[model samples]
Target: MLSYTGGFVLLAALLHASWNAMLHGNRDRFLSMTWMSIAMAAVSSVAVIALPLPADAAWPCIVASGLVHIVYNVSLVRSYKRGDLAQAYPIARGSSPMLVTLGAALFAHEAIGPLHAFGIVLISGGIMALALQGRHVSRSSALAAFVTGVTIAVYTVIDGIGVRASNGQALAYTAWMFMFYWLMPLLFVTMRGLPALWAPLRDAPMAIGSSVVGGLVSIAAYGIVIWAMQSGAMGAVSALRETSVVFAALIGRVFLRETVSAKRWLACVVVAAGAVCLGM
Candidate 1:
């Protein structure tokens, strides 16, 4: 079961990195993120219709998770704007699992075995190394990325509890959360005027395509994490999911044309080892 969960979360990590790369590569990241949210909400709407409504207990979590995700999106855009993907992405993603581990123990009464705890430490350390080993990232970007990481941990714990409260309808909880989370981002984008918001889509075919595909990838990635959390320890699942930083580093070098040093590649190797520990 642990191996299966680890494998799925690793897949989610790859998908998560791919979408982040797409967002980082776009000209107007905020607008691109808005479009991606719309696509996610649209795709999730179908799942919402098909799945049973999450139990009443899950609604509060769904709403809370949605609000937190808004902060996450805004912070991520700010972080990406201020720094390179390889740096900002690792910091934003790497800082979360530790927070999630503590939050899970405190709020959800989830116990972490010694091996799992070690794994979380390794993953977090490796991720931080990826950020620190490369060219220096600005303080503002690092701050924004840290804020983004906090939001990720918050929503992750919320969704973890929420999925269990979903009365065996984890899919329903995930779908509803995704569907409503876009409302604020959509409104924020619309305030800039429809013309401004739609300009990227109108002018850049690649932008529009990436936005749509990113949305799908984002949803799938998160859905897998949520599903894994249903039966797996939230902390372990979170630690595994955040291995996305490794993929993000690779994507940064290859696609985004960013610099990744040998030390950072070594950091990626450490993260993979951490993932192996979790899978044990």
Candidate 2:
């Protein structure tokens, strides 16, 4: 299981970047996210029907993490409203890994190897530098991004425990978690009215298709990481998942045609070096 953690997190990283790119591409970030969540809810509703119910012990974690995710998603949309994808994405992701890692050590009795610790530092440093570079982000955007990071850390830790308490029903817990998490976004979208809600998709079937694909990609990514948590160290898994920041930069450059400076490339190199250290 440890040996596969690298591959699992790598896959999660790529998928995470892809879905975030899709969210960034939309004209209305929050609505786009809501639609994505709706798609996730649809799929998850079906999944929960097939899976066994999780133990009573797992419900608290599921409920708590769902609330945290709603906050995270709101912060994400707000951050991106005032910041570039490259800047906001890194800032949102940068601090989370370390927070999760330290929390795991202190509260969950998880141990990190010296090498893994070094790698986490490297990854965090690179992403933070990337986040703080190349833009005049508003103070509010920075705060939103910082809050997003905190939520990411919080949910990561919560889910780590939640999935563990699932009593052979971790996947069911995940399905339920998605269903619960969708409620906040659905409410947000509904508040915007029915016509406004359907307008984006009414014109673009391709957008609908892409959003569905993005939602699925995101679910698969988290599914892999969540499953990995059962047998791998939570801190390490969280740090490794932040490799998505590097992929985010690449996504910004290619898909969005955003400029990639020498600094960004250097950050990517640092991220690669950190991944190597993580693997060792």
Top model number, lDDT: 1
Lowest lDDT block of 10, candidate 1:
271-280
lDDT of 2: 0.79
1-280, model 2: which lDDT tens digit per residue? 4666778788998899899999898777777777788888889999998999999999999999888878887888888898877777777776677778777887788877898788777877776666666657566776778788889989889999888888867689889988875685567756887676678777876776677788888888888878878767777777678778789989999999878789877876676566556545
Q: In model 2, which regions exceed 4 Å deviation?
A: 271-280
Instruction: Give the winner by TM-score.
Output: 1
Candidate 1 collision pairs:
none
Give the TM-score comparing model 2 with the true structure, all chains together.
0.91
Per-candidate clashes come to 0, 0
Per-candidate TM equals 0.92, 0.91
Q: What C-alpha lDDT values do all the predictions have?
A: 0.83, 0.79
